[model samples]
Target chain A: MLRSPRAIPYLLLLPSIVVIAAVVLVPVLVSLWSSFTPYNLTRPATLFTFVGWRNYQRLFANADFWWAFGRTLVFVTVALNLELVFGLALALLVNRVTTGRKTIRTIMMFPMMFSPILVGFQFKYVFNDSVGILNNALFSLGLITRPIPWLVNGALANFSILAAEIWMSTSIFAILLLSGLLALPQDPIEAAKVDGCNPVQVFRHITLPFLMPFIYIAMTIRSLDVARAYDMVRIMTNGGPAGRTELLWTLIARVGYQNSQMGMANAMGYVSILTSIAFTFYFYRKLSLSRRYMGGAE
Target chain B: MAEVHLSKVVKRYGALEIVHGIDLDIAHNEFVVLVGPSGCGKSTTLRMIAGLEEISGGTISIGDRVVNSLPPRARNISMVFQNYALYPHMTVRENLGFGLKIARQSPAVIEQRVNEAADILGLSPLMDRLPANLSGGQRQRVAMGRAIVRNPDVFLFDEPLSNLDAKLRGQMRVEIKKLHQRVKTTVVYVTHDQVEAMTLADRIVIMRDGHIEQVGTPIDLFERPVNTFVAGFIGSPPMNQLEAMIGSRPAGPVAVLADGTELPLPPEFAGRVTADQAVIVGFRPENLYPAGHGIPAAGQTLDMDRTVSLSEPLGTETMLFLDFGGREVQAKMLNPRLVAPGERMPFKLDLGHLHVFDRASGKSLRA
Candidate 1:
């Protein structure tokens, strides 16, 4: 019996399908099933037990978990907005550099080249109160007589983490938005200038609107990056100082591995997934709206 | 009051100068076309007048004020770009009114001006549509509407119709002429197409290598071109140019052709040529035709009994190609007839309509 042409196509796809099922589908489905159980990573036999809604109930009652979730939301929102502003400014300035443009573009990507872990360690030393460079410079400049606790105080610690996060990722937005700026057609910009628009008005009406879709894309990517703010925060703060810098991932990591309450950690993880989904959906909607204005698909 | 004047305007890029110093004066309500081949700086001249390009030297004045240092908006001129340049994010109505809005006009006045322009260009229905939604021809109309809405001192067009299909270009050409008539604004149009310049311009400025070759009315350029470049560039199926030495004939002075065909020079070129002097003689295809068929073969005839190499029938007339002066010279047959390739044919070159250019400098010898 000879194999048909239809069977050959399916035969060619068999390897990819099997790999996807083993690598992606199985792990996702197993994790989803484990979220409904009171399974402990240390006690393998507990995976057989089913305790519906118990972990979720404990997570709901735990005010600390709720605070971490809310704080992460605020963190992502504030950090992303600030990144957008700085990135747009950087891109605008870089776009105007007629000479050595390629060199400037390469220089803009220098911050993005550093690992987030290294960045965290770097900022941790800079924010150290006793002998850090910042406090010493301030003391020498007569700006501050006392050594300020940059990483100890609640507001100051959060600001320090945000500053590190922004410094680490703002280049991503600048690079993406720079590509968008370069791709923008020159005709409309010239047309706007001839239409009596001053430079500010031209930017507000023509350049910014053209860059909206790109902005939303950068926002979506940065939101996801800030939401998973683990390695940097863990190295720098470890969610200490009265849980002042505690975020979803930091809290979940402690409960899952350190405290060994995997069931409750998985429950909190499921709830935190909602925030990422909301941001992605909102950015997608905004992106499509801007694209539609550009005469692409609605 | 909106006359435009350019006095010794020059353009340079670093050490390499592009446009040489040239002067021109455009009257109010006049349509002047800057016509030239590519890289001739015709577009640069238009851009300088529009204030998009800085003039390296000299001055450009629109109406009364010198607009050398003024911005494009301050110069009070509107331009239609080659690509239409309609704002993609805005509706046609918004695109048309954008200029007025930036000028800080009242809402009612902006709306009225926009509507009037839209009405003139038949763009009322497409006003709500984006430029992406409009056809090429429709987009061009909206671009025109945008220019018209401003009611500026002058209108500049940088080959606006070059992007359209040939049929659409012909249609839009008439529309633009009618638009100028209705609006009565000074228009400085630039095009590489001589036909467009001939049909639409009150005066045509021929440019070459950034220098103004000649400036004249359409008929003036057609009838009295200053050089071989203009004679060849200004006409379709361009004038045939042949290098020849002036050979003396007892009857009169004759031009010894490249293929050794001796033809008497036109009477108008008597003093301009002497025996053994090298000159380039040109005659349009329309002036050469099958003998005894076109314009009665007046003055003198240089007869050629040659084989028809190819014939292109253009419905009303036929163009016959024959070997002359070691190259193919075209002759127009006004009355169309069936003539096959390799068929023997006799044609006559019309001496009365000859153009004689000096060989070394390509300048016309006709006074």
Candidate 2:
């Protein structure tokens, strides 16, 4: 009874822990347990029936699932790398400007501030084949004669979605890398110049290595966000035409919400979780290695 | 191996001129210390010489080459920053060799130079350690070693020891002196500590508000200060200045204190006295002694019934702060006893070493 005063602080945190477990952890575990049965949302009583990996067996045989899995990997990898390149270029350009720097930084964050859904609607109007501004400009300039099927074709729709995803999230990488650039110590740069290092040598040896950790941090964050590229892809193509742009999310949504196969959808969700985990682990390892390059383990 | 000459060098930051047009000539292998208070533009002057700062007006030359427009690399001068800005990502060995490597020097030559610098700094065991793993003193030594391996014509130090603790500062001061002696590089060092300026400098340039107040050897500035600022700045415990009036008499000159204590001045003050005017009396604490030690009449002495304020007994000598005639006076006593507070002690001041300064200009009348 005397220890109740000291224990009260921890006791107060129990409510928050319980809420989080009920809302987040319990649902994930329940879904994971249901993946072993033939549970359907329409037939709720079937959740207790044991099916023993029948959904996973069906998933292994389903060619559409395999196609969707490969497509998601390619979409994530391309979008992330492209965003990195564009983000690095933007950061470098903005870092060089001495005046109007604050205005430029604020403008750079404008794209990131808009909700991804709004971005999808905006790009959807812009890339629409019949009455879109892009095609109208092209036709008026004598660039094209016919209405191009931008969202209907397989490669073009995938590229259009990838382009929108890159544009929306590239600013996140720039802001992070720019802060890294600002925090770099000026002494090494000065020392290198006095040591007769040319501009390229100074950047390759000193500036780039110092920016590696920040780059990895940005990469980790963006990779997770890109792996779940759903909003724009969901609104524009909706895995349309013939499942040409069907990523994992669209396939999972179709299986669970449209077809009511809750067990198969849960199994797919668990498998997709490994992609985010692998990326996070990879970036974390790189961050630690870069910190070791700077000094002892940070 | 090079002589640096600055002719009317000026540094201005958008009309706020920090380093006024000042001329100086540093002969080959001469160590000059620029001593001043903070914001006195001493470090700015060194940076100008190192080509880190733009010369607002006038020419700076190294070995007869006007380097006013040259960059830091082309100027062939190295600098040690106050923070010891070693590259945190590189090992000690790589940090020392980075410069030579960037310059495209031969691999063997770069290796040999780095080895020599590493040996000079006694960093053989720590060559593999990054800067985050090293101590402050080790990092400072690496900074020096980095500068040394460049073998530039001149070296500049921007108050490099200000970041260290007092004991380490004293130790590094000796090491820097030894390094300078061995290398014989024409070095321009900047510091605000007068003791550092006194101990390390061949010539000390005292600055005030962007103007050169005085430039002379340490002893020259000590024995013959051009003004009250230099007089008060270049000594430990500081030279004591007491407000008084100079009363010229038929015999010689006498400094009359406000408390009506008249003291005869030095014998060489026949021609430098004006009529009745306000003046300041300056003397070192070490010059004052107890009155019973066969005091002379030609040298003036003051007898005061003062309560001891604070007594600092520093093994060989003791510092006593005594309240005298509404002002505080610090005296350095040779064999001081443990005098408690509120005890009246008979203190006397020696007048032979007394200095008189004009109240309006703060210029020493003796100089």
Candidate 3:
């Protein structure tokens, strides 16, 4: 029996509130609490044993954790920037297509349609040192005297994973940027031309500025997506040839699930979330600045 | 300033030709307006002249140079777009200085030109504001300022005032006229509003369905339109056209209306028509008005009584709508009067200012 209008609103919202508590809120609180304790999957009673700052102190002192964190930062930064550059180029080229535009746009999205696991397996096979398609092509073209250890070399393995990530996610940036291009008004471009700007000047001054907001929006989305990259990296290198291609997510998965160190893994996960937050904050500021420059609300 | 010339200029998109081969000449420092209803090829013609659209055939020359292949920048012309396409990211000052900057002009010259344009357009205070921060009229001024900074040989305006409210449009229209007067470069403006054409044009080119209907001074077009379309298009409330047969009276030639009413045609058209030939009689609302409430006709006038079906009182004058020749026609009354519907009023038809056109070809019967 609802006694007041305020209570009625709460009663209606109670189901979603209960569901959130059972799913998101409860799990997040449990993980946060367990990070303060030496909780392991093998010992059920250790979940309640409070270990204070032990997990966090060990996490901070761990060299492997610091290495994985630094690698992840570099991975996210390099991957997002390269994706933006390539995506912008792709969007600009696709925008120039006059005929069969719809068909081309659909085809452009084909890479994004594949599941991440499928993308991982596909790139894993392509980067295989002995029988890989890439090395075979290089050999047949007389470009290489021997098969390159694509997934074996530390630098090459990281580059391979970055390539797969860029291939699967660049279309997201292109589609978003292309929508911005389509919605761009023709008058400004024409005005720029009549204002004595050449094609390059028109693009540099008018088109680029118009696309900045869209570019920032795409960067913000892709940064968060790439930060949590695990399944693809897991299948491709499984952290490494001696942990060279190890990222934060892959390392955390191995430590938490395989090594049964859930408390240390949860601490790593919490630290890794800060990277996403930092990227998000940085991109959001850039987005708002660009929007304001375009005479939009801050 | 450079005179612009078009010789058989045409525009085609694939197999569909929108602007047929049409020729026009604009003397240096002249303000020419291309005016017509929507889809009349006026805008296409203006864009061709601006070098924004490629001519499908023929040559467009600015000054002594044939600029058919020249880009808009190379042609040395500036255009103000209908939407006032000021770059949203740039300040008014930057927008004004952009062309000069792109041209590799020194900072001093760019600043001088931009400041001069800003001063001319009264945009100094708004120089730092982006287009979105400015009001409609301010943005319009900035658009003009951008054009003005270039010191172009010709200025192209594509319905620049069409975006403003009526009150602001009137103000901008006056500003544009002043801008042309001060700048004194060749100007080609396009608009469908005939009032703008009549007010601002030194010479008006009236177009219809991809063809030039007429080209003349505003008064020349108002007083002597070469065809029925020009006659009806160039005036407000348009010239009323009533279909009739050319009948001969003992006095001279007469136009016999459908309702058996006969109005005397001007003596100039006496030899231009044959008796019983199908023709259309055209006269302005001012020419057919309340007997004493209008300008006295120098020639003969036919008087009649008709019931006013509706009245549109526009301050100094009122337009009365009533049946004439079995079709509704507009007649004007000057100096002030409130005539209600169903009230019978005495009207005069001025024979001195009458127009007769061939019904088949719609060409004026004037020599």
Candidate 4:
């Protein structure tokens, strides 16, 4: 059977197919099945007991779960948008630099080089209320007599986490957008200049439209990455100080692992998957639309 | 309309100079073509006049205004680039009107100008189509329409028809000439094709090695080139040049070839040549023709019998190659008949249309 020409392609793909089935499809199916049962990790025999819609019904009624879901939505939105704006600015500025560009580009990628866990630790030390570098610097300047509680307050903690996430991920957007800027043809820009466009008008009319596809692509990748903002958030606050900064990921982790409530957590996980899908679908549609507008391959 | 004048203009990149100091004057509403081979500073000179490149030394003035400091927009000149440069994202109508929109023109004026240019370029049918959706010729028309809508002081074309196919290029050449006639603006065009220069220019400026070799009307350059370079550069198949020594014969002065073939010099250069003076004898292919199959000569002629090495029929005429003084020389036959190789035929060289150049300087020795 393997000697046939039509079977050769499937034969070559056999290893990857087997690995994907074992690692991805099997685990996903198991979790999906477990979401319908009251499967506790401590009692493995309870995995067979079915409790259809019970975990989902409780998740809908739980106000803490809704608050975490809403907070996660806000976090992903704010982080992705701010990252896009700052990244575009960085790409444009670096593109204008004619000299020592390689050195500057390498330096620009420094933030993206550090792992998210390390970034979380670094920001945690920076935002510590009593002894952080930010408050200490403010004290040395005589600007503040007392330490500001950066990571303790409700709104300030969210802002601190946002700042850390933005710092760690904005370079992703910049690098991608910079590649787009580099590939842009110089003829259109020169033509715009000769057509009586000022620099601002040139950017607004020519440069920005040409960069739309790249912006959408960056937004798509960053949105999916930001929707799963768990490691850094867990390291920084651990959903602490009366759960002011409780996001869906931390909430689900606490319920699924710490409390050994795997069924409820799997239900939450299934619902959160909707947000990632929605974001990916929306951005891909926008990417294709912008690409079509630029007369690129659809 | 504005007349463009450049006085000793120079261009330098860092410490290396590319365009040496050169002077040229283009009259108002005249079509002047700057033509040369590749890397000959023709495009660079056009860019300098368009204010796209800064001149290192000397001044460029358009209509008595020294526009050295002004940007391309303030210069009020429109240029069609070689690549068309149509905005890929914009429709044809928007691409045509973008300049006026940027200048803060109102909707009515912009629409009027855009529609007028679109009608002129036959782009009204493709107004809503993006550049990528249009064919190559249509894109080129949009580029021209974009330049025309501005109604600029002068029109600069930088090899604008180079991207088109042969048929489209020929069509665009005629269209450009018609455009100049209808618009009547000062036009400065650049191309490397001598045929384009000959057909389109009122006066053609030939450049080589960053220097202006000659500036004349097409017919003037064709009839009396200042040097061998222009003679070879401006004609189809190029003029044939032979190295010879001037010798005194009993009848008059003759150019003696290496193989001892003596051809009578033109009457105008009778007093210019001395015995044993080395010179280059030049004549166009039409002047060297088969003996009985050419235009009736009005002056002295030199006849030779040579074997035809090759013959190329060009529909209206045939180009015959034969050995003359040990080198291949091309001769034309009008109302041509097929003549095979190794056939001996009599050829005539018209001394009335002969060109003599100094061997060392390559400059025409014509009075």
Q: Whose lDDT is greatest here? A: 3
Candidate 4, pairs of clashing residues: none
**Where is model 2 more than 4 Å wrong at Cα?**
A1-18, A38-63, A96-103, A142-148, A292-298, B291-308, B323-326, B341-350
lDDT of 1 by residue, B114-174 (tens): 9999999999998899887888899999999999899889999999999899999999999
Instruction: Quote the positional error of residue B252 for candidate 3 in Å.
Output: 1.7
Query: Which model scores highest in TM-score?
Result: 3
Fnat per candidate, as a fraction, reads 0.49, 0.48, 0.67, 0.52
Candidate 3's C-alpha runs over 4 A off are A1-6, A293-298
lDDT of 3 by residue, B301-343 (tens): 9999999999999999999999999799999899968888999
For model 3, how many clashes?
0
In Å, residue A99's CA in model 4 sits off its true spot by 2.6
Which portions of model 4 miss their true places by more than 4 Å? A1-16, A293-298
- Candidate 3 lDDT at B236 equals 91
Docking class of 1: acceptable
User: Cα deviation of A48 in candidate 3 (Å)?
Assistant: 2.4
Global fold similarity of model 3 (TM-score): 0.97
Candidate 2 lDDT, tens digit per residue, A1-298? 6467988877888899899999999998899888988889999998898888888898889999999989998998898888888888899889999999999999999998888888888888888999878889899999999988888899989988988898888888889989988887887777676666667877888788889999999989887788777788888888886999999889999999999999999988888888789989999999988877565211
Per-residue lDDT over A209-288 for candidate 3, one digit per residue giving the tens place of the 0 to 100 score: 99999999998899889889999999999998899988999999999999998988998898889778988999999998
Lowest summed lDDT over 10 consecutive residues: which window, candidate 1 chain A?
A: A289-298
Instruction: Tell me the tens digit of each residue's lDDT in model 4 across B100-154.
Output: 9999999999999999998888999999988878888998899999999999998
List model 1 lDDT by residue over A1-298, tens digit each: 2398768888889999999999999977776677778878899777678888888888889999988988999999899999999999999999999999899989889988888899999999999998888899999999998999998998899999999999988889999999999988877887887888778998998999999999999998889889989999998898877999999999999998998777778888888888799889999999998888687211
Of the pair 1 and 4, which is ahead by lDDT? Answer: 4
